[model samples]
Target: MRKFIVAFFMLAVLVSLVSCEQKESQVVDRKAEMKTSIDSLESVLKAAEGDLDEDLGLQMIDAYVGYAKEFEADTASVIYWYKAGEIAQNIPGKELYAVTYFANIFEDHPNHALAPQSVFLSGVAFDKMGDKERAAVSFEHFLEAYPSHDWAPDAQAMLQMSTDTTDLDTQVKAWLENANKTQE
Candidate 1:
C-alpha cells in the first residue's frame, strides 16, 4: 500500500509538470496565431484607402481582444487591449466593447503605461454612446486615479461637461442677459 501511494504521487507530480509546460506552449502558439491574423488585418486596413471596412475592422478588434483577454499577464496585452478599444470606439454600435476593453487595461493592469489613457478613453467611449452618467463616472474615476497624468485635464473637462449637462442653458442665460443689458 505504501509503495502504491508513493508511485501515484510521483505520477501526479510528473503530470502536473507536463500540464504546466503544455499550457505555456499553448499560450505561445495562440499568441503567434493571433499576431499573424492581426498583421494581416492591419495590412488590409492600410490598403483600404479612405473607406473603412467594418468586417475586417471587427475581425482585428476580436483578435486583439482575444489576445489581451487570454494573455493578460503579457505586457503586450495592455497595448492590444487599448488598440481593440480604439477600434471598437470608431465602429458604430461597438462603443460598449470599447469601454470594456479600455476598462480591462485600467482595472486589470493599473500600473501599466497605458492605464490612464485607457481609463480616460473608456470615459470617452461611454460619452460617445450617450451614456452620460456612466461616462461621468468613468471620467471622475480617471481623474481621481491619475491626477498628474497628461490626460488629466482632458478627463477633468469631460467630467465637468458630463456631470453638468447645462452648458447650453448657461450659455443661453448669458446671451439673454447680454441682450437685456442693451435695454438697461
Candidate 2:
C-alpha cells in the first residue's frame, strides 16, 4: 500500500510539470504565429504604400487586433491595439473595428501609455462612422477621465459638434423643400 501511494504521488507531480510546460509552449507558439502574420501583412503594406490597398490594410488591422486580443496582458498587446485602431481609421469599411480596438486599450489597460490616445481615437472612429450619439458619448468619457489631456479641447469641440447638428440638418431639410418646390 505504501509503495503504491509513493508511485501515485510521483506520477501526479510529473503530470503537473508536463502540463505547465505544454501551456508555456502553447503561449510561445501563439505569439510567434501572430508575429509572423503581422510582419507579413506589414511587408505587403509597405510595398504598396502609395496606392493604398485597403484590403491589405484591413488584413493588417485584423492581425494586430488578433494579437492584442489573444495576449491582452502583454505590453505589446496595447501597442498592437493602437496600431489596429489607427489602420482601421483609414479603411472605409472598418470604422467599427477601429472603435472597438481603440476602446479595448482604455477599457482593458487604462494605465497604459496609449490609453488616452485610444479613448480620443475611439470618438474619432465613431464620428467617422456617422454615429453622432456614440461619438458624443465617447468624447464625454474622454473628457471625464482625461480632462487634462492635450486632446481635451478637441474632444470638447467634437462633443459639441456631435450633439448639435441643427445647422446641417436644417440646411439639408431646406434643400429638400426647395427641390420639391421646383419639381411642383
Q: Top TM-score: which candidate number?
A: 2
Write model 1 residue lDDT over 45-158, tens digit each, in one string. Answer: 888863567887788898898888787778788889899898899999999999888888888889989899888888898999988999999998987898999888889889
Residue 59, model 1: lDDT of: 89
TM of each candidate vs. truth: 0.76, 0.80
Off by over 4 Å in 1: 1-27, 49-51, 167-184
In model 1, residue pairs whose N, Cα or C atoms come closer than 3 Å (at least 3 residues apart or on different chains), thus clashing, are: none
Tens-digit lDDT track for model 2 on 31-109? 9989998888887777776455777777788788888878878888889989988988878978898888888889888
Backbone clash count, each prediction separately: 0, 0
Q: What local lDDT does model 1 show for residue 45?
A: 81
Clashing pairs for predicted structure model 2, backbone only: none
